[model samples]
Target: MKAKPAKESLTIMNELVLPNDTNPLNNLMGGRLLHMMDIAAGIAAQKHSNRVVVTASVDNVSFKNPIGLGDVVTINAQVTRAFSTSMEVRMDVWGENIPNGTRFKSNEAYYTFVAVDQTGRPIPVPEVIAETEDEKKFYDGALRRRQLRLILAGKMKPDEATELKALFLSEE
Candidate 1:
């Protein structure tokens, strides 16, 4: 399969925090933000594979800042790696105060998506190539992340996580 650059799959989604999507305190709801992140990640995955995709898993989300109503929330996503049938999408969230024109980093998340056929069966996807320094760092870390995910899911043994093992365990 041909390799696609990470930049080609980059996607950004912006939303204005509104009363309907916020809590009584006027802060954006966590679930609503997660929904936006998922949509953005899905778009990045599809852009990379050009196939129907589904969210397989999402890593922990740490909400650092409370986004107030009227703040613009921006979610950025990019395909960091394309595994056999799954792609890892790295997402970042930013809260921008329009009046002050100031933006602050809120949180980051990693989403795994699987490309599927019309029958909803998983299918192979094109590999992702890292072109820039940041992309390369993400690409390099993807293997370890994938291994940890598989191990935690019981789909792979801890011994098979060579990338992760090498990072934490010292040689004799």
Candidate 2:
């Protein structure tokens, strides 16, 4: 498969927080934000793979700020790296109060997705080539993050995570 530039998969999605999307405190609900993030990340993964994709895993998501009911939520997603049939997508979310002209980062998360065919079987996807320094950094760190994810899910043994081990190993 041909390799694709990471920027080609960039996806930006926006949503206006409403009464039904918020909690009693008039803040956007976490689940609602996560839903939007998933959609943004899914679109990015599909753009990178050119195939239907399914969410494989979601990394730790921390809510850094509460989005008010009238805030506009923006989610920026991009494919950071591709590994075989799966790719990692990084999503940054921000909430802006247009009236107040204030914006704050709501959260950031890494979501893993696997390309699938008609039968829902995993299919190979194109590799991602980093073109910017930030993209390069995310691409390089993806392996370590994947290893940790696998370890936490019991899909990979600790000893088999060479990339993660290298981080703590010293060269004599």
Candidate 3:
């Protein structure tokens, strides 16, 4: 049997925020923002897995700032870690100011995706390589996330599991 390909190192997807993307308050709708993140995550997964992949879960998505109309939103994604069949993708959302030529972080999230074969069965994912310090940080965060998932799934007991969940929810 052929071995799986190595995980993707980096991915970035950007689009200009339009009026339709925002809500009545002129802020980007939460669901629309999540949709953008999902698209970015799916692209990153396909690039890494070289096959069809599906989003299994979004761990914690928090919107820190409201994206106003005309602001360009950029979603950056990277593979933090990988297991036998699942991979963790970290996505950061940034807003670019059209007038000031500045960019602000509007939100961030971590999503989990599973690589699947044509039959929709989970498959092994290749190892993720850390090529730089930032990559290392992302990997470390992914490690923590994996541990948290284990705790939630009853695979492990972490003393700070409750604290972790609280922190994650507070961001939202």
Candidate 4:
């Protein structure tokens, strides 16, 4: 793919976390955090494709730290690639203590979404252009993540997926 001028991809959702969005332990619920992630991803897809987007699959979502109530939880999302009708979005979550001004990484995940027309049918999406080294690295990582997604969707066998994973992860 030809590199295009580096553009801003991250769409940060600010102030989405609230007091009632917590669990019994007073931490932000995983489900709630997931919902916010999805929203941030949709916004990124929409910005990239300029079309209505719907979530197709969430590849991997792992919580790294607890998100406490009243913290400013930021959901940062970006479009890593786009096919004819689908795009991959990678997201990271961070929690900030409003009072102490401390920020901590909370979680991260990657999701796929399909761009749709007004009729709710799949449509063409824009090309993915990776400019800087960081953007290129992000795109390459997204490819491996997509392979895992194909395995999860039953389109690829476990052995093949494992092989692809090994090759993709070899550089690391």
Clashes of each: 0, 0, 0, 0
Per residue, candidate 4 scores C-alpha lDDT tens digits across 143-172 of 667777888789888677764658747564
Candidate 1, poorest ten consecutive residues by summed lDDT? 162-171
Cand. 1 TM to true fold: 0.97
**Local distance difference test values of all predictions, in order:** 0.95, 0.98, 0.80, 0.81
Pairs with backbone N, CA or C atoms under 3 Å apart (clashes), candidate 2: none
Candidate 2, residues 1-172: lDDT per residue as tens digits? 9999999999999999999999999999999998999999999999999999999999999999999998999999999999999999999999999999999999999999999999999999999999999999999999999999999999999999999999999999
Cα RMSD of all models vs. native, in order, equals 1.0, 0.7, 5.8, 3.2
RMSD (CA, Å), candidate 1 to true, equals 1.0
Model 3 clash pairs are none
| Residue 83, model 2: Cα distance from true site in angstroms | 0.7
Give me the runs in candidate 3 sitting further than 4 Å from their true place.
1-7, 153-172
TM-score of each: 0.97, 0.98, 0.82, 0.86
Residue 3 of model 1 has an lDDT of: 93
Candidate 4: pairs in clash: none
Report the Cα lDDT for residue 92, model 1.
88
Candidate 4 overall lDDT versus native: 0.81
Best by TM-score: 2
lDDT of 2 at 165: 98
lDDT of 1 by residue, 1-172 (tens): 8999899999999999989999999999999999999999999999999999999989879999989999999999999999999999999899999999899998999999999999999999999989999999999999999888888889999988989889988879
Best by lDDT: 2
